[model samples]
Target: MSTGTERSPAVVGKLSTLDRFLPVWIGVAMVVGLLLGRTIPGVNDALSAVSVDGISLPIAIGLLVMMYPVLAKVRYDRLDSVTGDKRLLAASLALNWVLGPALMFTLAWLLLPDLPEYRTGLIIVGLARCIAMVVIWNDLACGDREAAAVLVAVNSVFQVVMFSVLGWFYLSVLPGWLGLEQTTIEASPWLIAKSVVIFLGVPLVAGFASRYFGERAKGRQWYEEKFVPGISPWALYGLLFTIVVLFALQGDRITSQPLDVVRIALPLLVYFAVMWGGGYALGAAIGLGYERTTTLAFTAAGNNFELAIAVSIATYGATSGQALAGVVGPLIEVPVLVGLVYVSLALRSRFAATPPKSIVHHD
Candidate 1:
């Protein structure tokens, strides 16, 4: 964990408050979404109309804002350290792309063969690695923030490039083992690039620029204290609203096919346990400290549901198997990650008696 002895009191105070309330607010937002979904029928469609240049405005803006803190905290110097830790990186990559997908596929086949409606849901959940939420998890776990930041940047870049390729491979080439029919997946590259620009590029650029300017003008203390806290809630609320809209769009299908949730949950739970455990063990075997281990574990375990959700809706329609799978990811992700945070804390003592030195630097 980053020691704050050198940090300005005001910045520390701001972060402390945000760290405390963000999760609670996120939980409440979820419940609110469920209630709204059940009580108000056309609410999602109404909200969906808030779009920019054909993209859903709330989701696009939420995605951009949510990434701000993530990019803001990243340490570019970590790129040098990445090469030094080749073993950890290779292990994470193999597990995330290879074993992770295979295990999810097997679990989905075993759990949901009878329910074809949710088969795509399983694949989407399995293939999408964590993008935004992992930053929060890494922060909470006192993980190597620099490494986590670098990994997230790398993953975000890779996700855009590999989404179509992996989506096709999973849907067509890998479906044979489950006796599933090959489904055609189509996405306009232009639209995807646009989404990536609005959701990821804008926030990333804005965050970097803000951090740079703040450091030069008011200082890092002022930026961290005043600006970050103010934006945090809005970003989180945007994410919650996005989730509500996503689930609301699928409310009718979910209400009708209640069993689909169960079907999607099984593989997801299995995938989470397997990936988290595998990453934890692998990190330990490589003799990494607790912070690095936690970072590696989450980097492997987390899924990028935003891109998955967008692609699912675009390629498979809102009510299709793909979109349902994307929706099921967060329902499983939130609580599971919270539990893992505790687990990480418990394992912290085993790795190092003191906090890792890597996390001590503020910048």
Candidate 2:
């Protein structure tokens, strides 16, 4: 008989109430936003009245608030153990950086050929791999927790470097190379770089500084156990506010063209399934066993929807289709990924009955 630890998590018990019903919250936010925008005249215009760097100031503030808490929760000091395992690290890097982005690019273009704004938004989504929530998914699925931590930390750093670069390349150069008439990306590389710096850079530095000082002052235990829980809810509050404002600004278009929301959702659904399945199959083929394989799959599949929304709004304006596409990301992702947690558990039997490789020991 398997030990209790060996058994898959009863997914319901593992997740917090907030995380378990995230889709419901997101749905309510959408409805509330739509109602606010539709029922209240001038709601959209008033929100848009204040602009910072050509984007609505509330959105910029919301993005920073949403991202900083999540980033602060990362254990940046623990990257050393994960680095020793070259095979795991290499596979994660390739799947996250290479396959993940490329697949999303292909899916976005193929599925969204006519809608250039949404297509570019999806590409931005692709470039942003590995979300903070993957930890919850991976843990519920019995994945290697340490590996997931390291990968999240790495991707956090990786995105700061590559988001703008990939945005420029995929939006401009790749389309040129493919001989396809790309949509006019009003934001140049310089503009994208500026957005990335303000949106990602500002929060990143703040997160790092807070953790560094917080831990030093009160020890890692208190910082994580006490300080983190205190601030974690702000991420959700920020996300809700950002969504409310975004949907409010674009609610008229979204309500009129409901088909556009459906279109944006289709590619995201495909991207999540393909990335998760591919990662699992590759993991089994390479003998990472169950835990590491599960970790690989969740990390590979999850996208930084918060960052995607931030960059999209900052670059394309809150009312643009690109922003709408980014808004639709977590809408589709939450329920789909929650379902995948069960799928991962059910399929855990397929891996060989073996203890996962003891590369990095996780608590």
Candidate 3:
């Protein structure tokens, strides 16, 4: 791994307390959410009372707060150079859109054949490519920040067009061809559009607008150094709040069905390993080098769970097995990917890294 300043010693010491202890906080949030859900008689009912298209309104607001800063942190100005590398672009797209979905389909079926709802939920997870947390993972692994930003922007755009189409192909058509039981759920174009528009699109535009105007008003240095840190803490706060609310609503069901959570978790664990490993191997095989390779692997491994959960709950119900499966995704992904960050660090020495000309990073 590159050292601290040079990407070497790319270890836990480099992370802030929030990022370093993320898994613990997430676990605590889950426990607290469960307690609130079970202890309070009408907590779930009250939380679910104010609904934004089936999801609790509090969760929706928390999501917006959680995402805005993350999106704002991305260096949108770097898109031009990243997109110039057609090889990296093509590899990322194939891994994310084509191979990623196919692999998840195989795993979900082979692993959870008897559970159609969970299988369908997993399939939706695969379809909703990463737009949010992958950047956090890439950063942790000392990956190329600009490349991740561009790739995430690409995935966000692709979701509008491809999520529904792929959802149909994988969940409905492919199953029919193979003579497996098909899921009754139909992926809605509008659902993806609205989620992307609100969750992804709204923050995206706000982030970009803030970057443009902030820099224009006070210069990049002031904005990056002064302004960014002030707002950074809210990201974790929003994430924790959202997690607490989600689990609070579904806590009873999740606590009750331990076996089902394990089953859903197994396929997701396998999916992350295969995707991350496969992505790194491909990047290294194709000579993308360390930084871009790390970015590629993370972008490939991560999925848009927010979109997946929103789609599941809106299409099914708040308490459906599909929604439950959707909730389990990040629960499994957070820690697994954190471990993978160290794996990427250890593996970095194996690759010969050639630094690009004049790459700018502010973190």
Candidate 4:
């Protein structure tokens, strides 16, 4: 909603072609992963065998690499002003923690009650929330960059504490209470914590440290223009690599239950559309400025599929229905978010925007 200023085509063109076609890459990753899983003899087993405890070492490495760049982009210094807008911040939190998950829970049950593993995966996707790519979506929508960064930082910290508890309660306990099938899935908070520590916490610390020291040593321009752009693609590569590994591990299952991906996708599609509209209406109703509203809308709508995928693989085997469901999340999300980007752009002129100079600036 925030028309910060009409950015030049040159500025918009700076967004890499790969970023524009993220969904295509995701689809390609799925096919490639399936191919590798089916064709390569012993490859899946070989990767699966390389584990520390229940966590796959290769997948863990992939997740860490995928997460760090996204986390590193957060301007932690900008966070001092996040609390300055308490109403908008409170609404953002409520959307992510309450309405977001509640909607997914109800939809997952209503749509996929017969498929518990896939249901659990959808629930996991909902709880993880967006910490990474929402920044990209927000930026594309001309949202307040600082608000987006601060909200992302807040969500990252909140997710570290809450994801496991919520994942456990919703996936394991809530279902049983509702008389849904008792799933064998172990949504252990510790397991979730360990995954969070490795995937989210490490990257968060590294991102902040990188920003603090790099800015002091080299200056903000060099860090943002040179360093940030350089590391950005690594996140995408890491994601594709992890996806390949996940699907390869689950080749047998994927081959057998091809329609299950479609099944997992249905609820996610609804979540994105409904949550985006809901967040936008809530923001407009609460008298939020366009930039903040755009930030809130994208942040609420985007799912941290990276974290969801990691947790799914950790909690359930890579080949389990849950892991497959997790992969389907990004497959659904990338294109959906891309479409929302256009929607936001089209609606920009209709909404009045406050100057975001006091809030944040874009690179």
**Would you list the C-alpha lDDT of every candidate in the order shown?**
0.69, 0.74, 0.81, 0.76
lDDT of 1 by residue, 1-363 (tens): 233232245544646454546567667766676667667967777767787655677666666656676567655445467546787677777877787777776787788777665776677666666766777677666677677766766666666676677768887887765567766567556655665566556766776787787778997678766765555455445556666665665555566666777778778888888899999999888877677788889989988776677777877787677787777788778778868876886676677542344553432
Q: Is 1 or 4 the stronger prediction by TM-score?
A: 1
Ranking under lDDT, best-scoring first?
Answer: 3, 4, 2, 1
- Per-residue alpha-carbon lDDT of candidate 4 for residues 29-105, written as tens digits (9 for 90 to 100): 87887788889898888988998766678877877777677667666766666668898789989999999889999
The TM-scores of all predictions, comma-separated, are 0.83, 0.71, 0.89, 0.79
TM-score of 3: 0.89
RMSD of candidate 2 to the truth, in angstroms, is: 5.1
Runs off by more than 4 Å, candidate 2: 1-20, 55-57, 60-70, 114-121, 128-179, 182-215, 220-235, 283-295, 304-324, 341-363
Which has the higher TM-score value, candidate number 1 or candidate number 2?
A: 1
- Kindly report which residue stretches of model 3 are placed more than 4 angstroms away from their true locations once superposed: 1-16, 349-351, 357-362
Q: Stretches of candidate 1 above 4 Å error?
A: 1-24, 177-180, 191-195, 219-256, 353-357, 360-363
| Among all candidates shown, the one with the greatest TM-score | 3
- In TM-score terms, candidate 1 sits at 0.83
Ranking by TM-score: 3, 1, 4, 2
Q: Any idea what lDDT model 2 has? A: 0.74
Report the Cα lDDT for residue 1, model 2: 7
